[model samples]
Target: MAATSSLFSLSFAPSRRRSIPLSRSANPSSAPSDLSSKPQLIELEFLGPKAGGDGSSPVDRVTAISGEKLLRNIMLENKIELYAAYGKVMNCGGRGSCGTCIVEIIDGKELLNERTNTELRYLKKKPESWRLACQTIVGNKENSGKVVVQRMPQWKK
Candidate 1:
């Protein structure tokens, strides 16, 4: 019985993901085993200083750290929680879907995940600086996409 259980465990256990070298040397966009490029917990103030949020005035640009806790930061800052839109209307919840929880990529685009057909469709409709929250999962394991998100005024829930 123990041997059988051991075998079952071995088979069922999740396999570690392997990282492969980038085929195109021009832009070696490799998916590393570790998210080393991600930040640790970037804070993106929604309203900005003028609105009494934080940071310099003229708030409007999005912010993020490569490995930061995105959702926690948003919650801590009292910003709108878009996680609620995941799966139902947005899907991926934070996996990056529905495009409902979209945010402008005010700064870091290189650090984000490559866009999908679904995301591209929405992005094409809007300005180039936008991306879906659920689909933008890049960055640290703790954070969905290591990005600080604020609900777009145009998005309906």
Candidate 2:
């Protein structure tokens, strides 16, 4: 009972917001910093389970510009295969209608755009980490300049 009362009192305590000016926040050093540097590039890693069930993983690397191309395009250009049936058929053709190109976001959840109506419909029962590669666009400053993803580990029939 005493612990609960103290918890309640703490919850009611006033909040202190420490706001720092944007310029100071960006430059922590006493000396002025260079402002003309280019934006940092992101390293995108794509991996998959190797065939023959050997438990080996093959990884592909690609540089990314946040908020640019869709994930499928990047994977295609970089030769990363998130779907087994890729290049075999239309496979929704980046339409986000089919969930065949699902990939698991190992990191950088906030970098991708919001889910589309098609993704919302198809991915209802899937885990939050799962997203349609065709529907996801990688690259965002909020992701610490990197994004990592893997092919979905399992398929649902």
> What C-alpha root-mean-square deviation, in Å, does candidate 1 show against the real structure?
10.2
Estimate, for each residue in 1-157, the C-alpha lDDT of model 2 and write its tens digit: 9999998877766432234345543655733554444455567877664443565566778887766778889988877776776534758778876678888888877778887787889889988888888888776543536677777655422
- After superposition on all CA atoms, what RMSD does each candidate show versus the true structure? 10.2, 14.9
lDDT of each: 0.50, 0.72
Report lDDT (Cα) of residue 51, candidate 2.
Answer: 40
TM-score for candidate 2: 0.65
Q: Write the per-residue lDDT of candidate 1 for residues 7-101, one digit (tens) a residue.
A: 88777654422244444433545435233454354445442212234443344334555554443344335554444434245344444435556
TM-score per candidate, in order? 0.41, 0.65
Q: lDDT winner among the candidates?
A: 2
lDDT for residue 38 in candidate 1, whole number 0-100:
43
Query: In model 1, which runs have C-alpha deviations exceeding 4 angstroms?
Result: 1-80, 83-97, 140-150, 153-157
Q: Pick the candidate with the highest TM-score.
A: 2
